[model samples]
Target chain A: MHGLFKWSSKWWPGVIPLVIFWGIAAWTSTATVEGDLAARSNAALKDTVLDKRRISVDGRDVTFAANAFSEDGRVSAVASVEAVPGVRLVNDETRLVPEAKPFVWSAERDVVRVTLGGNSPLPSSRSKLMEAAKANLGGVEVVDQMGLARGAPLRFDSATALLLDQIGKLKDGRITLTDTKVNLSGMARELGGREAIAAALKNLPEGYSVAVNDIRAPPYVFQAYKDPVALTLTLTGYVPDNNVHAAVVAAAGRKFFSEKVVDNLKASIGAPSGFAAAVVPALGALSRLSTGTLVVSDREVKLSGDALHDAAANQIRGGLGRDFPQGWQYKAEISVKPASAPVDATVCQQLFAELLSKGRIRFESGRADIVSDSAGLLDRLIETAMRCPTVNIEIAGHTDGDGDEAANQTLSEKRAQAVMDYLVRAGLPASRFLPVGYGSTQPLAGNDTEDGKAQNRRIEFVVK
Target chain B: MAALATFFWGWLLTAALLGFGMGWIAVVHRAQAVSKAWMRWLALLAAALVAASFTRIVPGRFGYWLDLFLVMFALYLCGCAIGSWLRDWVVTRSTLAARAAKSAQNDNL
Candidate 1:
């Protein structure tokens, strides 16, 4: 065994060929895997679509061909295929089932389309079919060709398009008319039944006769009842640091304008712009909003940050004016709320606590320049101001005793004014601001330790 | 459970292989001069500490102090792998070393 081990060591050079062979084997195996990966990455799901016709896909290529017209019947399936493994491409297009085109009948509107049939209605049946189509399909239009009867001119009502929108609420599965004699085809529930259907049909003066078809029966006709005049709107926005949310709900409270400008718009004569300025238009929309409320949830949107905040505010104002270009079809609802508010007692308390934790605002020794690291905290405060345009802001600066009381007062006032300038540039009304300096007189914390001193040299928001 | 076990095995094998290979190189330094390689490994250890501590990979909640704990765990695994590999290398070289020693002795005698 020892001799063999020695021989194995001496003949180790002979194993060079074996090592080379193993290297080649490993390389070949690796190449095979690489090829598999390439194939998987490149492989595409072949599509063989049959949309009333035939479409075949091989990799990225598509081939479309149609077979003798109607033999495939109504091809209703919009089936798509995806690539599986191993096989590069696979598709089956040999056989396909024919679909049926069912006659669409409006049992309540008293209309039905014989789109695929070849038969004409009698003169008496002509008006009956037209009437059926009219009473059944709302504003969608009613056409009765009466089976290729040249120039029969299928009479239709354009109002059919807007009628069925209300029937969506009727719990009764069906509505039956027996007077002019017609059947309404829809699933109505028990909550609103035959009497409700009668009430709905009572107001239709649009040149048509409709009546109760039956009092009780399953698989019966149903009128899809619809409510004509009802709509809803929602409001969302940010508030300012010191702003308070008003609890007044601005709804369509007996306030309808006698003077309307360019449709769906009614405004007071007291608008800053003659009801047509960009601002006036937005204000006009805000007025038309039949209902509004203010809420302060964490709107984690970028509405409170940099250019994004301005962009968000612009989007809010701009969206109001154009929420409905076709005119406020239904009584419009609107809300113009703030981002955050310190003028709000509750929010101010929370914000104060937040600032307290961020190492109470301080200054650089005896200098009036604000410290650098606390810039982020100031940035957040500024962002809060940008959110609520409804409230006025006051920057009250304070200090701890070290210098002459008068000089301290002057420095505190300058510091307060500096913050105001930043806010004004950042887009706040200067008229809505004031700066006050409290020099060493009012300290929320003690003046003994560094921490207490830091707390004393601070600023806060007081609502105007 | 089986898939998870397989994943654990894969991680273990990769770590073991890395440690085994590095351990052999470290041991071979005992036979030859490889001060630069030793320093490079030492630098890698320091780098692992810094990367794990401040690089946000471990996260603030985990705290940076556990960096030494993780490093020690890694070193222990590496040492075991290196020790095992060294044992194997010695076993494999024993007969050859013996043969070389005998041939050289015969020539001298």
Candidate 2:
């Protein structure tokens, strides 16, 4: 043992990281598979939307009894049948509901995007818009609005959203469109400062400074980094000025613990129990946090910031910190804020059984590929798309800073493209889908740790 | 890992022996010991690689960490080994010729 120790002292300073890398690689390598083939074609399924159908059930014909038909080949509709429980050989026609098509469903016929920037309307404004679009995106079809509204100037929310969308699509970290209302998130102080966020916001259409308040210190000072993040703390009540340095360090450790937990949950907690299990350990430092409420469960776990007294029973799961293997923020919020928040009740029952997790399907690290676990959630999205007939989708991808800027850009684009491919394969109109990638320039969450990174690597759906 | 051992172990051992021999020569002849010092570094790295492979069979989390450290060091040492070997070779060749010429010239004197 002494000899071994001597050997280690002389030659093995990197053993721990290598082992960790090896173990994690082993655990996650099993996670990837050669494309888990979505049934290529749904020929067996029926698509009878707008097509007339006559069916017989139990030797009896049922005509027009609240009939249902879908154009997507996956979903099957059954004839409605109400029969007495004890009756034998009752004549009833009930069709199986058709499997939903993997695409975005649109409800409106005319979804128009009016871009005000570079809006020098030509002699023919309608054709000009189409020409401008065709120059950038060839073969994209647009239905002409019979009477189009005059394009308005890009300002506030509109400009911010457009710029934010652009910033989100820039994989190389240079494409930025900043606004005061727009907030760029996700960064660890150790790697770089908040300058990237500031830089992103600076490039907006004159007079818009993006918001970076999320990383700044609170007014009363619940948490403060002594000299910007090498040390930080979140103490209850107030900071004792005399022991500020030590107190901050303790708080930072707490914060780090909680942040890691949140990120882990954000990444893969498709179930309520899994969310609780992922979050409990991070909360130990936040003693005041007793009853944690899960605001959103299923594939996406948007934890609620509520007290123990107001915690939801099944929604608040506990003891998942064992798998955290990372750190977090101090004095973490117990649940999502606001009592009136809409909490999905389905997740509390079966965590992995995702009903609506499309909101937070994150792409994996340094790549555009959706995580393996995203299949079920993405499938649900495809089903919803099939049900909604006329909608067009913008498959937008986002990333957090943890790699080379160029790589981040490529990954973001690739991820969006992946979603597009999935939707098209699922029988959505190829023309209806748009794929775009936003690198680490735009962030919904802080990009400082494992947790924040997980939150930032996500895709959004804008119904057009 | 097994391949790394077979691939790099002999060269590393040779570097270690060359380094030890050079150190003795440098101290006796007032020559620089830079080449020798680097050779020892290579030997230590080779030893690390040998130690790191134990992770494949080792139990416990701590062992895993240890294995990582060992592998990194072994790889680093291996990188230094080739350069160190060439340096030692150059030094020994120059010193041997110098000693032989000096002895021959002294005999004539």
Candidate 3:
């Protein structure tokens, strides 16, 4: 053992450097082989219609496991790998997934390319399908691997063409034709796309019918970007119809005083339930913000802005959600605007008028009790009052000629006092406000209709 | 007594090897735990000191001190380069292996 140790000590040091050099050479060579194999395999299979491909190298032998739609693809991949210079052998463990039946033909679209696969009845039909896809998709790559098969139903070309037309309307999804029974599953590119396709399918050639339609319409989007500095509200996205469009524009007009409404809305179908109910109140909330955005996508209302004050911000955050229709939700990102330089009494009265015009303070019928829904408007009034700190204002309450003059005057007085009391409780000085009642003496509109009466009975802030 | 002193230098070299080697291993195994670059530099300095002591390229105590300081700086730079290369290699290998495994599993399905 001692002699053996002496021999090993003498020879091992000399052998050590050689062993290390050989190890490095082998490691580098294997790394090169691995890298080369991966690159070559990817380049060869990239253009082929293979579903899944895995390439592994052990020495010079390359193993490929993949799924191919056709046997030709599998064979081609094996041949290509075998021809690569360093590869001694190719192991192809590829599979072929059976196509679904009644010979379903489908076109699938994604961000970049549209893949048209499945069975076609004739070679001419296949070419025509590819031509149509290329024509409609506009610069998107069209991959065609449609196979010729029998058993296509009567008027197959017409049905397939109809389905292909519908595919152009999809954002991402597949449309399939199974023996003249069509199945479509995907997201529509725009609002009312599903409805358009459904309407078109009703005119399909006789004997063809829809089996399943899983197509979904895009979100009912209503977005208004309020640029306070620009004094403009740019309305974009879809509204249900021309009437709804007109209503929304009028609502914007009522809420945003003197600001230009840049209407860029498209009239489309499929407005969510209670869309009007949600959007009208959302516009009211948005009007209270200094600069804000209101985005109503489906039943979700998202309002974000800098409010005029802490009271306005708190009211918006707390009240907007509850005002929406049942099952409607809201998210508010409200921040209080910095205190503005105090304005003169005249400007303060103008601001107060603008606030009141957007929304009204309400009271229980024939009583002085304020409705809880009027909190948002009152908050805005208080914010305006705080801005004009040096000014004293008279809270004048008016009534329509509906009740006795004495009772009307008393009720009006009590309502004006209620307004003053609310402002005082909200941290404003009571001395800054004077309550006054003008009974049924003066009217802005005729008191014949309810709307006219509603307009006549209002609370006005007159700067003193 | 002289032989014992030489043995002490050998022991110091061993300690230096352990310091740098263990530091490298720790960095590779748990990158977040040993994130400070200074710790890596200190370990490299320890390693270089032992190497310089063995080489004895300079004469006397001043030479020893100079060798220690200069070699520390030089090896710290070398350590950084080696550590970066090793880290990249490990990460690339892991990513490629994971991709290949996923592909193989999908192909099997």
What are the lDDT figures for the candidates, one per model? 0.40, 0.39, 0.74
Tens digit of per-residue lDDT, candidate 2, span A16-65: 44345445533432122101100111111133331223332211112222
Model 1 RMSD in Å is 40.0
Instruction: Tell me each candidate's TM-score.
Output: 0.23, 0.20, 0.56
Q: Is candidate 1 or candidate 2 better by DockQ?
A: 2
How does residue A234 of candidate 3 score in lDDT?
92
| Residue-level lDDT tens digits of model 3 in A1-464 | 33222222222122233334334434444455456666776677666656557888655456788766567866887777777664445667887645445777888988788999888766567889999989988888999978766566778787878888888888988887777787889899988899999998998889888999999988999999889789899999888889889999998876666468999999888899889889978988887787899999998999999887776787789988887789999999999889877888889989998888877778999999986556546867888899899999999999998979999899889999999998887778999999999987788899899998999888999998
Q: Provide C-alpha RMSD values for all models, in order.
A: 40.0, 46.6, 30.8
Q: What's candidate 1's DockQ score? A: 0.01
Residues B74-107 of candidate 3: C-alpha lDDT, one tens digit per residue? 3333443344445456777999999999999999
What order do you get sorting by TM-score, best first?
3, 1, 2
Report how far residue A373 has shifted in candidate 3, in Å: 10
Error of 2 at B42 (Å): 99
Candidate 1, superposed: residue stretches over 4 Å from native:
A1-349, A356-359, B1-109
TM-score of chain B of each: 0.37, 0.34, 0.41
DockQ for every prediction shown: 0.01, 0.01, 0.01
Docking class of 1: incorrect
Docking class of 2: incorrect
The TM-score leader among the candidates is: 3
